[model samples]
Target: MTSVQDFATYIAGLPRVLASAAALFRDVEGRVLLVEPNYRDGWALPGGTVESDTGETPRQGARRETAEEIGLDRTLGRLLAVDWIPGTGRPPLVAYLYDGGVLDPGDLAAIRLQETELLSWRLVPREEITDHLPGALGRRVLAALDILTQDTGTAELENGHRVG
Candidate 1:
């Protein structure tokens, strides 16, 4: 497993912000996958910073992150959107969003979360997501879901402002 110190070093070596992939998985019932952070109180999508030495494509990174975080091996879907999360002390993060589909229903029942970073995992509706997730992350999750589900007429940000 990669440590935060190692990740920070990797980020420091990069010329620009590090690119990452987040897998958005939805069940037939329209419940999306969310993970609660053990270190933090809010929920977030199952993902991680893209490793420089992994030799995996962004889609592969998304698959690996989903399995590691939520124990799922699913078919990856469209390259939804890329987001630039402002950096604090470290470099900013360039996150690639991908649409992922659940391969097996049984995997959902047998989820074994990696406890170091995650506290628990769930498949909940968009309406309930706001309750479990923090403000900005929750909005991003819902926006990504809307883009994937085609629920919103426009795939762009709801407020008509560009996402940096």
Candidate 2:
């Protein structure tokens, strides 16, 4: 019989791609929420990599990342988009974008950026998202916003574009 330790060892040695989740929050006037990460020159949506083998779903990871990065405890409304993107030297990744809902003045004021990994946070107008986020991510945000507006269900994408 295979021992439990052998099974655990086999699983740990298996290669897997990284999975990340982000919350797409907007303001009352229809701007996207972007956070300035300390490690990157450009801004990105509030999110992080999912903890593997932790029994945590993508939705849970999205909510947790939003709270951790922006100090907001609001509920993530829906699954706006899902993207499968490849990486340079690392494994490919699956990214989830959740609807973080429109924020009011009070909600905006309550945002507190995580000082360690995040330098600051701001609301960028829908048209100006490209100025902040990088290429694919900027496109991803724009596509997500489009999906959000039509009141349609969700968008399935590969590298931020519609797959089918």
Candidate 3:
């Protein structure tokens, strides 16, 4: 499993263009899975940039992230949304947010944390996501979740929101 820092270093060393997948996992109980960063102390949806080794599709990247980060076999749903993180000393990130459903809840409970990146994991209720997440990523994830649940074509976020 690749650590987020290692992944960032790898991305930093590459060319300016980058592609990533943000996989949103939801359970029947209506709780979403979120990972807490070790260094930043904030919650984020579990997923990562697409790697060359895994091929070019965002769906493939989402599947890989699920196995690597959360230890689950998930069925990839529609491409719910896309957002771009403007360049800030590093390459601009084009993140593809996908709606993903897990095959088993027990597998989620059995997740093995990659300590270098994630400090811990939690199943957070929709109403309480804002309290747990730190910043913009929270808003984006929640918006994506709303769009996914409603089967809507667009997600609405506040300032700095990006959807494609």
lDDT of each: 0.73, 0.88, 0.75
- Kindly provide the TM-score of model 3 when superposed on the true structure, using C-alpha atoms: 0.74
Candidate 3 displacement at residue 98 in angstroms: 1.1
List, in order, the clash count of every candidate structure: 0, 0, 0
- Candidate 2 Cα lDDT to native: 0.88
The window of 10 residues in a row where model 3 has the poorest summed lDDT is: 155-164
What are the C-alpha RMSDs, in order, of all predicted structures? 7.3, 1.8, 8.2
User: What is the Cα-based lDDT of residue 1 in candidate 3?
Assistant: 100
Best by lDDT: 2
Give the TM-score of each candidate.
0.74, 0.91, 0.74
RMSD of 1: 7.3
How well is each residue in 38-155 modelled by candidate 2, as lDDT tens digits? 9968889998888767987888898888899889977788898889898889989999999999999999899988899998888899878988886778888988999988888788
- TM-score, cand. 1: 0.74
* lDDT assessment of candidate 1: 0.73
lDDT of 1 at 64: 86
Q: What's the residue-level lDDT of 89 in candidate 2?
A: 94
Candidate 1: segments with Cα more than 4 A from true spot: 1-15, 102-105, 151-164
Worst 10 residues of 2 by lDDT: 131-140
